[model samples]
Target: MNQVEHVANLARLQLSREELERLSTQLSRILAYMEELNAVDTAGIPGTTSVVAGDANVLREDEVQPSLSQDQALRNAPDAVDGLFQVPQIISDR
Candidate 1:
């Protein structure tokens, strides 16, 4: 089993021979580009977390405000029981 086949199995994907070959070639090119980038020298340059330069907070401060009551919140709910929104059980015991 090749790297692409192993990766496809890990991701639970069922790929044909053609797809696996194409993906393998693409992955190889990407890895080659990464290797080329690794050869570049970045000695004095500081590592950047964000491209946008700003130390100040751009968002407004959070303020406590009055919210809807339980009844109001449940008013538009499709299903409600005992002051809680009722949703269909998604998982079942096999």
Candidate 2:
């Protein structure tokens, strides 16, 4: 089996002869472009982990605040009993 066939099998794909030929050419071109990129000189250039380039995390101070109680929270629930939200039973005995 060829590289295309091998890759198709590994990916659980069923490709026609025309599709296999087309994809093989496309993959070959992609690999060639990667090889060309690898030949470029990147000396002295710092590697970038992200495009944004900064610490993303910014947190606010945690403080006590007035919020909804259990009754208020469960007011919109389709099913609620006492102060708890109820959901349909999903498990069944075999």
TM-score for each of the candidates: 0.44, 0.40
lDDT of model 1 at position 14: 99
Candidate 1 lDDT trough over 10 residues, lowest sum: 52-61
Point out where model 2 deviates above 4 Å.
40-94
Encode model 1's per-residue lDDT on 60-94: one tens digit a residue: 66988799999999999999999999999989978
Candidate 1 structure lDDT? 0.89
Query: Which one wins on lDDT?
Result: 1
Query: What is the Cα-based lDDT of residue 22 in candidate 2?
Result: 93
Residue 58 C-alpha lDDT in model 2: 69
Cα deviation at 85, candidate 1, in Å, is 13
- Write down the worst ten-residue block by lDDT for model 2: 49-58
lDDT of 2 by residue, 9-64 (tens): 99999999999999989999898888987778999989877778584876788988
